[model samples]
Target: MTTAATDLRADAEATLQRLAGSGAQLREDQWRAVEALVAHGRRALVVQRTGWGKSAVYFVATALLRARGKGPTVIVSPLLALMRNQIEAAERAGIRAVTVNSANTDDWQAVYGEVRAGEVDVLLVSPERLNNPEFRDQVLPELSRTAGLLVVDEAHCISDWGHDFRPDYRRLRTLISELPEGVPVLATTATANDRVTTDVADQLGVSGQGDGALVVRGELDRESLHLNVLSLARGADRFAWLAQHLDELPGSGIVYTLTVSAADELAAFLRERGHAVTAYTGKTDPADRERAEDDLLANRVKALVATSALGMGFDKPDLGFVVHLGAPQSPVAYYQQIGRAGRGVERAEVLLLPGPEDKDIWAYFASLAFPGEPQVRVALSVLGDAGRPLSTAALEPRVELSRGRLEMMLKVLDTDGAVKRVKGGWEATGEPWEYDGKRYLGLAKARRAEQQAMLDYITTDGCRMEFLRRQLDDPGAAPCGRCDNCTGKHYDPSVGEDVRVQAQEVLDRPGVPLAPRKQWPSGMDALEVPLKGKIKPEEAAEEGRAIGRLTDVGWGPRLRPLMRSDDLAPDAIVDAAVEVLKGWGWTERPTGIVWLPSRTRPALVESFAQRIAAIGRLPLLGALADDAPPRYSDPEDDSEPEPPNSAQRLAEVYGRLSVPVDLDPSSGPVLLVDDVSDSGWTLTVAAMLLRRAGAPAVLPLTVATTN
Candidate 1:
């Protein structure tokens, strides 16, 4: 090697020693990646295994470049948890790292000041922040101008074909295009197939050839990961099995669930079984999430019951086991999640407790995927005609999609250059756009296939590790001598009868309190609805209850198909409803019952309501979804095509429920019932009608609630 090459290697080695230890040595491939970035100023993609020192490459490069007076390294990361870990790790290596994210808004000004003053070596940003108006307009331009190195961590998200779908990642192409020339770029991910790798590299403006990134992909298999799958068809059986076997597992690790409700419910059940555990999901508060992560790292908890929110970039090297309560939809996702375990240990047990509800849960999530052409057209039309930038909430009253879905669609539109996210809100670019129906259809097909692949992982006669490796296009896919399939050492999935009984009780018992809508959705006046601000307490519904959330462990999914049946709710459901009523903390008892009009399954809802009133010996009132003509109507059009937005939907439903005009407030509170609570708007409107018709308090009860 030449003199400068030797010096670069020595500098990188010194940085690695600081990062790892006095004797820490750089791996050959790690050095090559570092050399490409620091010496040649070339783009690099590192696709190493979870513990193969992917992070070391970037940190070492950052140190070497900064020594030569390069600007601070900018890393576009996926999760706040990941950013927190990176910031901590960078500090340990003597790199002054800072983060800008939603959780640290109060610190942003200070952080930006630090960046401007050259006191920071590495800066981590969440992917969504790439287009955040404040960050994108003011802070991001400076980052682009002065960033010495650019890194996209968890780069699989940049691919259209990757297991994870994050639209904000696509904005990296624009960021890359705007970067100053010859700024070395690095992309890293523990999870990515050949397809994803190519897509990400191409998006980074690299073609994987001469003058392109050095794609350094190492072996995908981890010799320390001992894979096993325990198939328990019943939900109760799965939890019982976990309760019985959690202690026998190697060390403190993670027990991943498919839904937030499942994560919370399972964590509680595990605690009841005398295990120290906590639930982690997207719903968890930012500070609490950080605490839970720290607790796990310190071994204060046996395992964190988590959803995919805990999936990417959490650094726990000695995690002994990874247990999945329900299968993830893709084998790639399953492998990357399990990579959290066995990193710094000799052997880490990775177990899959596949439930029958896994497929249904996958289907429910799939329903939230990209919208169809008509909905996309509606949003575009609204934007094109508005002629002004509209914030997401302001646009909601004119669009049919929920807030979450609407935001996701807007991001996708922003990526395609059809719209731009500006300081005020989002502005239409007036770029001609067409929905990629074929592309979306292909994505849908790929999702179904991935779900099948996960199912196949359970029943596959081949090596479990090999099956997962092959799913990611690993050319070195081979039998792992330690897997249950290879060694014939299957786990005993048996649950004690006592454990089963206790778990079944937890499943059978259920009630979820439903909070009433206090404030009206914004931009109602723009939709020509005179309503705005908080609904008067006298005109609002009191807090209510649901038998459970639609994502609950056992009862939630079962209700959907059962709701279509003409027969009344089964005795078990009716019994649960009674329990909910008895447990409800109502200041005054409800004097009567009122059912929401169901556009679908009216007979089922009405029958359920009649049974509840008879059992409670209370009076029954009227139906609500669309039973009464809207209180407000345009004289030119007696009817409006089902109002397309929130304000429109509220206007159409407002004062429409025909409550008895003579009903007396002294008759006491009214029990408002719906078969399902989706968006909770209809329930809000119906409750307002009852309160206006002289009911002192309106309480809403639904069999299940959907997000």
Candidate 2:
């Protein structure tokens, strides 16, 4: 197979020019991404957020590569719906696309053959399809001869921390590696944090610059959406609120429910109210599911009542709203579901219903997530006594449950803090027990806290967005200023009389009431550092320390660093000192750090400062009233952010990348950084370009840069 760069790629360039002349205006990033692909001969990670026209990153690159006479790109997606979605989009763009899924056996073979023979430019298949040993061994090897790329979409699935965790995704690393070295790998996902990015690079075996290659993200916020949170007293009240708003909310929308019964009943209720309603659930057949999806997309139905499973790959730009009938199990799930609306830059609403039932449901789910102490203890004992990996089947007789139930319990335990799942079997994490007298007390305590958080969300009048942001471990978020409590007349209390004010006044007095607040740092140990501490204002003032401890640990750092040599007020001194500590890696910026003796990483200094800054904005509520339903002076802004260096860009770039470069060419078509290369355009492009151009040697390096 000839590489695009080696062949001088006139055909590809001609095809690209033709497409451009035919009305395809490539954006700068897209152009740069594609150029990097052809020039470097290696994969690149492209992480553009939604509405960044990420598809063009792949569509144009694939078209350009194929136009240049390179082999077709084989995209391994996770969902069949995603395959169909992309294929249809490609067809609309005048690009030929097909899929190899379970539904089409003979055609799948034919397509596989065509791809191997260099007859096709793009083929999409679900990741599960590649799990077939026969396809991986037989068909993939044949296709390998023609040169192809492996594109893993929704790359976050590879990380266990992702909300949508899939065990099958773990095998993606092996599958990509099986491709010849020259074939670049691209992995993309909408949401990826630092940990997720690291995991993705590790799984793909990306090395050096290529391993670190990823596009920073864009904001995921849609200002057109009028976000709202309606805290109802009961499930019935939630239904009533939905009914009240149903007439006002126009355009097609989705109503996501927590249960199959809820979806069905909601659909029925809406139908009774004289609206065309479609219901979708896991039980729906493929035909029905597809029809329901099409109906929702086509605006044939006024509303579709379904579960979170319904919206993964469905792109309905005009969806005016997304209603969560019940609180989601986690903030991640909530955000993704609500993100479905306002895709078209139009005003939309995300109505969250957190009724009493939701609290019960959340509590039940938390309990399920954290098994009983006896169960955890039993599982641990079994694992400890075995001293060997025991399969669920083997452990069932001793555990007193069906193998399936025991396995699920074990998974929950894994999800919770109780155990770890391994290829061999489950094992105790060996974390210390929580309570000395009781064996399962720790597990119980964790479950109770989780449940309590759920209850807090349902009952608290505080800012919902703030709670969510805190849960996601991101505190830079300000009040959304648009949620129910944030905008309500009830929130208009005098700044001095706000919850924080009252709490601060009470805390200002020294007494037993302040003692528990002193332990706030220890009680909220997971959120240590940048909370509160025990240092006195006078001492802090004299020492030029920016932080004064409220509790032994939880006080926000005083803003001493803001002080100038000529003017050093106590607050200014504290803020200024905070900056110094942050610079010295003793505090986290955007928040402050507590003087905890353990787990103090230097990188978290700035984060600690930032955390300190966060709480200062809160009206000082007394320690006892701190946990109560504190009234918000204003809602904190915690809307969806621009994809902050997400994974989507990287995956898309990798998909279309065929170039690999080394030594950071001072002058060249582009610099391509790939994790590794055994065969495709990356190495081919570099070698051919250097030889043809008569330039210096090209160096290909991986973090563990492959030769």
Candidate 3:
């Protein structure tokens, strides 16, 4: 099995040259992985640094294997961005690569036909699609049997957090266990500690003992990465710093945020300050995300304000810098993100501006881990009693879990064989499942430890790169002589006084449009709510405004602790609400004011509305009073984000509010006030009641909204 000495070697070399240009050559480790997969048909794991030709190995091996009449290679890629890059590279190598992902749903049939007709050499599929009802029940069985080589990019994801966040990845274990003998399998990752490496290798090995796989690991260090950290006490300060110094850093890059709201907020600030930037977060539309990636790649945008959703999407070796608005929870995760930078450039600046609210964000994500045994039991029982399969949407109301947690649980359960994802949805397998309390405990502990390590990395006086490397358990972890500490060249954290003021002003600028909900929550029939599908256009509230999102940098932090405070909203809060109303730019000024009775924060809502009515000198219409509707309880964990099904919520809110008898609607649009708008259902119901009372229009104004 001397692959390098064989005639097939030329094909592999040519493939590399095609993808990486005429001078491209495979390094010894690349050939070793290629030899294992293509020549000897054995399993292997390659742990190399980013930009170390990991993709090169697989594409070259893919071309070589196809030359010998092997079936198409199926790569289980993790992100849409990663899939796009791989497909582009494969095309350059003349390897017909196609992807099956959520974004390309319309082309799935064509892609499948191509794969079956041997027109495709490489097929990339997202981990989430691994257990898609149709894909899992129909496509996977055949793909599993005929795949020539199996490649798991970002193989580190097979570990704990991956299982929790992307539970469908665990299904690969079953896929690997059932592969026909002698079929080559390769797993690759740039970020994996010893534990992760061993765990992934064990999973990759058919024997399940991990000894059957060849493990190749290289030193994890990037010379082009110049690491530095700047502590910013306030979210506004972070934005101010970026606004002031972003152009001074390097070429085009990314500015990372912990939350979607932060990304949206920061990008708006940067763009207002005359920077070409855009926000890329989990909430961004798939088509828009792709456009943002293209803009960043083309250098049309100076930076992309993004969250972790942009991770692993870059194949660009020339990305100049990466700046974090807040630290990620794990040092390895941080290292992986920063690795996206300095990949192709001689020097790319990597900066971390750790915010005070980082831990809160960390705890929020950590809380989404595997649900408690009781919740799992509820889900299982719901599926068990159902005579037919149930889709995630149909099951969400009964499971009492957020969409994220519910989908995650279903995937984990599917992987465990406790439930099966059939064509329509999931069905209970009647497989007795034991809740692994011990494993969950260990995961929790490991998460805390990793978080501590991340904090240490922030406070460390030692080399930043060395600290990250050591956290990943690299033997060669030592001072890189290039970091801020090692080079004695720290980034100046100072922001110009004027720029700082501008940033604060931007944050303080209130008035976010509260677009009225045109559609009632779907599946309301299950909750016995009369509302279904689209709301009547005439009954809908007119587009309105909120002071700001609760996630806003300036108002959000101030409003967060105030969500529970029933005391009168302070003068400053009242003043901000007035500002949003004053600047609303509405087509028709609200003729009168009406307030919603709050279950919590009654004083705040009334006081804020009273101030607005007094300031505007409008008639003070009475509240849309409620009569003890069943209220949803917050999760004991506090981080399990508010339950998300609007139908169930509508059920609790429907018919609960009544319009004031004395209110006259023919005058004009009336202002409807609330302390906060979350789900927008409460406001929707209120507006409907107001409209029913003959109001020409209802304009909703809230101090804050969760969206």
Candidate 4:
């Protein structure tokens, strides 16, 4: 055993050295952690939040293990997207790695052949694939015969406690049982608490005896991060706050909302305010997700407003902030979601806007934890068995509860420090007990205490990290010192603070417009849309008439008109106030959709019109591919037959519609004449054609993407 372990250690080291040479810069602490894994003859469990380079730990470990003559290293991941990404990354690094996913059959066969022949170094497989019988029967037997290392990425999912729990993940332990006895196992995750740590070790059957399993915890501190949380009341005010900030902190950022509809609406709202935006949700097509991600990375989008589904393995280093439109269930989820920002060594911002609805959503989730104590006790007893820990596959059918209920039970147990999560199983932290012989009542009391702890954190008034620690019973632990509450600051929420302040100073009055700055000769215009008053128009009219009869006070043109309009709705009256602007060249498409073509400043009109047109044209062009021809003659007009695809559509549209003279290659920058970008085919193809036609550059402008 000693000799074999030493050999594995040596092999893993060489791989790390090679990786370091290949452009991954590991800090002293990070490199030390990798070396510790090899030197101790132990499997490493690296838990670091997003953007901390979690992938590097496994990549280096797998490389080192294989270089030491390990037959093949199998990586089990949750998503096929993640698997594909790793495969492509390895190939780009000149490492021969292949993956078996839902996409290919021939590729699977080739990988199986390579494993059987002991010719492959890294084999990336999804957890779902491991359950397939054909691959198990035809290929796994060969893997058992050779020296192999099993790497579970996103290992936290093995715990019911994690935000993302897949039923297929539980079966991973059973599949790993097929590996040679004493074969090493390594698991990696972004967010895992202490309970999650122990669960991973037990699941892999490498426990207290130290069958070479070690924990490596990365530092969670991100000094460049600036966190801000707003306790909000009104929807319009919330949007108003967002608009004010985007201008100051301009660049790539993600605005995370609770639902797809919210993401779409928020994206639209931001785009209308002149920000280039994109919206994403789980319902978005995978290909479209890839395109949106690419556009974001290329700086084609200034912002992306999305739901939680957009996260995991998506990296863009220069993100300016990660704004939370709604509160998440737990700090773990919040941390993972917001860790996407400030990754490029710049000070990044985090804005959390919480509303009353968040409280209800959290309460609903907490309500599912009933009988939490007994459920945790059951989970503990199951893990404490001397036999191999039950994998996700084995536990699901045997639990006799819905998968969601089981997951909730697991999370409660894990959060309460009653159970620890292993790579493929869990570890019991001893069964739940009462303070005295009254076991049932004691358990009930304990469970309530735990529930209260969770609730207290949610509604806390003090330091956020302090509350988190108190819930964990680790109150002495120093504050995270990174959260909004810990920072002791608040961004000005007033939408017109600067203008109002300037006006106040200039006019020596509270309500007045300030004079313009030296460069901006036009005064700053920021209007506050008022809320409807409680009094009805009829009541107001009666009050007005009484006052007039007594004091002989007559109303003027503007003031008297309001007294006579008893039938008008408050919203209708406000709408009428803006009618003159609309008739004088302003445009109103629908409620919440308005633009000013005339009477509006020239620069603003030109910018907004271009953005609107650009967005409208995207649907027509998105049908084309990268290699498709630039232009095709219209066959309907006795010209060459029109190209049948996206490329052809672009040519036809450009041929027939008005091409902005500014976008003509012979002219200046390719003009972007639209506000939203749903499918980028039109703009992308047009830009490509212009480049092919010798244009120096094409500027594609859009208010937002369907994202």
lDDT of each: 0.85, 0.50, 0.83, 0.53
Task: Supply the TM-score for candidate 1.
Answer: 0.95
Q: Over the stretch 1-707, how does candidate 1's per-residue lDDT look in tens digits?
A: 99999988998898999888899999999999999999888998888889899999999999999999999999999988888888888887899999988888899999999999999999998899898888888988998999999999999998768988799999999888888988999999988888888888888776567775688988899999999988887889988999998999988999999999899889999899999999999999988998999999999999999999998899999999999998999999999999999989999999998877788788767767888888788888888888888999998877777577789899999999998998778888899998999988998898899889998999997899989889888899999898998999999878899999999999878788888888898998776767789988988999889898777777865675665454577787788899999999899899988887764556767887988999999887656435655543321121532223456667566645555555444378999887777666778877777777788898999887764
Model 4 score (lDDT): 0.53
Worst 10 residues of 1 by lDDT: 634-643
Candidate 1 global CA lDDT score: 0.85
Q: Give a tens-digit lDDT track for model 3, residues 394-438.
A: 887676667777888888888888999888788999988999999
> What tens digits encode model 4's per-residue C-alpha lDDT throughout 1-707?
47865565555445545644544466554565556544444666776656676666666665665665666777887765566667765654346777887766667877787777877778887766654556655565676567456778888777655556554566666666777655666777776667665676667554445455566666565666776677656544566667667767646888888656566656766776677888888778777777777777788987778888777666677888888877776666676777788888568888778654554445434434334344445545666663555544344433333345665555445544465555555556675633223543653454455444544554565766555443333425456566666766777777755533432222121111111111210111111112122322211100000001100001011222332222222333223223312332212121111121211123432434433334334212111123422344321122332122222233333333323333334333333322222223344434444445444444443322222
RMSD of 3: 2.7
Q: Which stretches of candidate 2 lie over 4 Å from their true place?
A: 1-32, 46-48, 143-147, 206-212, 359-707
Q: Per-residue lDDT of 1-707 in model 2, one digit per residue for the tens?
A: 34844343443344444543554455666555555555454665654444455555566667766765777777767666677788877765457788888767778778876766666777887765654556756776665555555667777676655556555566666566566656665666555555566667677665236443444344444455666666654344445446545756768899888766567656766675567888898777878888888888888898889876685566777888888877775565565667677877557777776544454445434433324456557767887777676666446535533343476566545434456655555667766544222523643564455456655655567665655545444425456666666676331112222433333332222111101011111111221222234532211111112222211101111111111011212343335333433443212221211111101122233333334435444121111001112111100111312111111211222232222232222242211112222112223323333333322322221111101
Per-prediction TM-score, please? 0.95, 0.55, 0.93, 0.56
Off by over 4 Å in 4: 1-41, 103-107, 117-119, 133-147, 363-487, 496-707
Highest TM-score against the true fold, candidate:
1
The TM-score between candidate 2 and the true structure equals: 0.55
Q: How high is the lDDT of residue 128 in model 1?
A: 90
